[model samples]
Target: MILLFAGCPQSSDKISKPGSTQSGTTIHGEKIDISETELLTALNLTRGSQSASEAAKKIAAQTGKNVGRLSFTEAKSLAYDDEAGTFKVKVVGKKNGKNFDKTFNVTGFTHPYASPPQSAIQVEFKFDAGIEENLSIDKYIEKITPNLKAHLTFSFSLQNGKAITLGYDNDYYELTAQVSNSNGELKISPEYKLKYKKKLRGEDETSVSTAYTSAMPVFTGQKKDYFTEKDVFEHIFNKVKDDPELIVADAGSYASSKYAFAMVLNNGGTLFNTGKIAQYVNVYNTKGADNHREIKNITPAMDNVRGGGITADDYEGKLTVNFYISKAEYIADGNTPDDKEKSGSYTVVRSGFKKLPSDISSNVRSVLEFSLGKITDGNGTQDTWKKRRINNTALISMKYTGINSTYDNWFSLNDDLKITGDTSGFYLILNGQDYTSRMPNHQDNFLVPTNGDENVKILIKHLQISKNVGEEELTIRVQFMGGNDTETVKIKPQSY
Candidate 1:
């Protein structure tokens, strides 16, 4: 399941500003400047077991109690009356020998006078009973259902051990919650000691990390379901544009499940050469001295395997790419060719996107040019060429089509061309001698196909590394000794 977070506010309103007393006369020459913001900040200083009202009370007691404050006193006492669902704070003081008073009322504020305390975080959950079609968020509820549930005992902690716990409960679920600072950031865990067992069966007990913290009051949904491509783009591209090496590797449930909701990174497109991540890991560049005797002079290589760079660039009217894919399944046609090593074929079926012209034969350059315009970073010369890699698993399949079909004599494997290696930055030595004998059953081959009988020579091969390093794709013009039969193909890497 893919979890995504949207519309989460980063900060709070009602900013605070501190200053000295204005308008009111000062008593004993002590200054007193108070705004709603300043009062909240000052009230936050009290130690454990102190409520806002209790803290306010402490402030009220100390007004003229010790600090040479303009004489002050609590004109009214706080009370927990069921009729009024809010806290009332009233303090009267003398400033500059003048009389003045301030009153404050807040609905969510704690009434220290009460026996039990409360917190600010309000956790809500939305569920779906049916399946979604587009797989976006169809069958899901916009906001949590009618259950105005609250956890009774909630606690959380950080990787470093610092944490906070609070008890909360309403009608449906009773929970003990804890939040801790995991390294510099906060981690929240809410465990429910749920009362109604059978009714909320699936809700028995689930420990999902809350995105809220002391520093940042916003609680992103549960960690597992909170990330999107926009989040990644904002954090990685916009946030760390200056640092090439800087990376935010999220190894949590939230980081991993984003693939489902991620539309920013298109998995299939023309720029992508290989199909899926597995396809790249399974590539095998078969080349060199394993069988054929007459075939010699082959150069092969594989580069940038693991953590290899994945790139999308415009090439000759196409969004050419160095993509990852599964291994190619090879099969040889059993046609009897004296020197053709049983003309074989290979199929590589990887799940990926392909960028092709509306008409394959149309000017490919036009498509490439258009793509470049869309991706080019402001400075112009190819800044949109970002590097990315995938380790996630994806499905892929391959099947070779031309196994044993006999081609018109001239198209025989003796001269039919096959080339491999180092295309994907991997290398394989390619240098072989062209030979032909005319004793009884001899055929002539062309450097560039002089005629139908004069077959154009081509090479087909794969390469393997000692410990399965990796592979890359290279673009080089391939042709016969003196002919023009050129096509671009990938030089994929393999593990074996």
Candidate 2:
């Protein structure tokens, strides 16, 4: 079947505000509404199919309880049926060592296929401990909620013992197949498989798939009720098949796609393998979705300084420190003005150090450092990184990092969380002004002028220095202001 799926990227921005809605909304003035129907339509599924109901009923039957329906459900489960064409199955399981109520509402329906269109019932369920108790489950909840363990399965067979075409998708990994003869009896057999991708340097694919099946059978025509591997696979496969994304890899495709797929499977989602044809699924989509960057301001806190030496009057005027930061722009490769694919943020932070006379009293240099912690993204998760393991750039600390109060600097920025990527310029900013002039070797010392060019936007300025020789404290006030940001810093004397 030609399934047209819309791959939408999820907003990683963290909403510190607890009341933030989980709907498709962007922090940066972007809003997108993706209804469950729209999502199902995107995955090329029967828009009105009560797949979730079927899955829920199968789960209820396995757990031995009548799990009810949810008012605000995203996806519907499969269903099951009894001899009289009535589907009413329930399953019961312990959660956190306690009993919780889970209901299934799988009702058999008539469809067009064979003369008396075979009534097929399917169901799905997952064992969830809690949001926190299950880390993998929580990740899924964060991405796709209500906390689920593994989706259970159930299916209906026809007169010829042929199972109908059914599928599932967690929007990442999926499994689908046309069973030739499945109308015999209900059987459950748990199976396991490992999925991997081919990595560079002949390395194995960095993806793995874990399968768990509950060997419980409901329609074995036996007094004892239990599920077999087939039932378990069918149970989990039904919900998983709904995702529609489970696909094979195409050469030259982005590796991030594999990472996204692995994440889905790792989070209690089942995947199906459709031999012969490859599946091309979108893990994330920026089009028609709310995905924006979030920025925050975090000035330096808990400050302390240190002294290196003292002067004639038993004073330490030679130990002065100040904090500063540099800003610059980068031209992304293959990025055009119309593309709007800029991938880095202008970071601002604070750092400082004491000034000590280097060699002969004539030459002096301040041992200062700078920090770029002022800008905080609403998404507090640490940067997702990949180490390049290649060293082609020089490493320097805060003070010596930027230009010496001269020459505008820049640094290359990219979405990759590695610092070893291609770097851009490193311009200097003196007192909230761009140091555009080249560093001059003039014998006289003068306050560096700021670059007021249209390209250079003043981010911070109005820096002042104060010192109390007696208390061994040095206070530096930086009236640094920025576009959509601002901050101040103060440092006291201490050890190195």
Candidate 3:
């Protein structure tokens, strides 16, 4: 919306002289002068709703000059000054071989922003040379024809309880008339084309963004003048009222019917150093004692596993215990006869798990053993392992555990969600986090299921990971109900 006020001079400045060609020189070969008092009287008589030609004829009659002897070249009015109760109009006319441009300090002219009947819209005119020759309204209309076939359009809006006028300036040789619409918001854009002898020359346009007000009476059967704020609210409410899934409630309220589960393992084998297993169990027991008052009430026996022992067979088998232990010890008899009576204890252990221990619900001791037989049994590269770990972790972490159907559908339609990097749809997740921050405030945190069905569609909006991870295919697994059925969708690597 760049506004250019090019070629318009200040009203206080003198009107530019017509071209120096002999054709432009005023007729009668001598300068003619009309008294200011007579001119003022004629102008006053023409003030209220009189066409420019009618005013010209009256002025010609009073000054004893034929209407053909005058040319109305320019006219402009300053903004109304309420305190002074006056508005200034500058007019440039040609008469008797001389240019007569004068500013009339006028009172009682209707203010464009005045209230009710007093606030009528007015138009002042300017014409090219010789256009005012016959001095009739029809003759005036004939000279300045629109280049566009349509009538001049206008839009209106109220600013601070007053109408803000939008029109082209006088320099463009275009005339404007005021028409009003009751609803400002319904106003159409105003555009006009200038034509000469039916050939298009130029255009003038204006746009309005405001609520409409009636300058004149609206017809009896027309729609109400304007839309109220409540009208907008009800319109939106009616659109979504029938959708039961769009209602919002707390996630925990539906926990009885909804279930979400996730698990991750490195090759499905569990291992723990025997000497450090006791310390790990003790730590878990301490954490549960310090943090889990609710769980303590349900499982009071959880505190009794601190002194448990790990046998030599457990160490050889690489078994994983399901209870907490802080540390472990190994005691051996001294080898020398002198030291036979003395026994010493030493800690010999490897890496320990950092996560809190969970109850061992299964009894398979071989579950911790690798089916691949040994560490060197397969073609296991670090790059492949790293990529698999990253993909596995990402797949498990990306889950829509609960339902969210109250999101605004308007935002989903308009915003760019980058579905498949080529198509457009709602973005559910990016880099394992919800895409809610990119959406508007009213939209929910998660995407809704399509019509509350068992199948969930996950659009892979984007993928950005380390180059070392290579081109990995991702599998999205969705479980709608607890152990009922699972749906899987595979997404291949795509170029950005």
Choose the strongest candidate by TM-score. Answer: 1
Whole-model lDDT, model 2: 0.24
lDDT by residue (tens digit), candidate 1, 281-337: 222122223211111211111112111122221111111112222112211121122
The local lDDT score (0 to 100) that residue 69 gets in candidate 1 is: 31
Ranking by lDDT: 3, 1, 2
Q: For candidate 1, what is the lDDT?
A: 0.26
- What candidate 2 gets wrong by more than 4 Å, as runs, is 1-342, 350-445, 448-496
- Candidate 1: residue 275 lDDT (0-100): 26
Query: How big is the positional error of residue 208 in model 2, measured in Å on the Cα after superposition?
Result: 23
List model 2 lDDT by residue over 1-496, tens digit each.
Answer: 8999999965322112221223221223222233333322333434123332233333333333222222121222222221112222222333233332222332332211121113345534332211112123223224323212243343444443433322333311223321111232212222222122212212222343433132124322212122222222233233333332322332222222222222212210111123211111111111112311111211111011111111010011111111111001111221111212121112111111111223212211121222112112222112211111212222111122443322222111112111122221112223232222322112211112223322212112233333332332223333221112212334331121
Tell me the whole-model lDDT of each prediction, alpha carbons only.
Answer: 0.26, 0.24, 0.27
Model 1, total clashes: 80
- TM-score, predicted candidate 2 vs. hidden true structure: 0.16
Q: What is the C-alpha lDDT profile of model 3 across 1-496, one tens digit per residue? A: 9997879644332212221111222434344454444455545653333322233334434333334455556554422232223333445566665866554444442222333222324222332211112122333334434421132323233222433233544211232332234333222223222211110112122222222233333211122122222222222233323332222212212211111100111011122223322222333333332221110111101011112211111112121222211111111121111222111211222112111112211211111100111122333343443253232322212223332332222122222222323121122343332323322222221222221232331121112222224533444443321122334444433221
Q: Cα RMSD to native, each candidate?
A: 27.1, 32.0, 31.8
lDDT of 1 at 149: 29
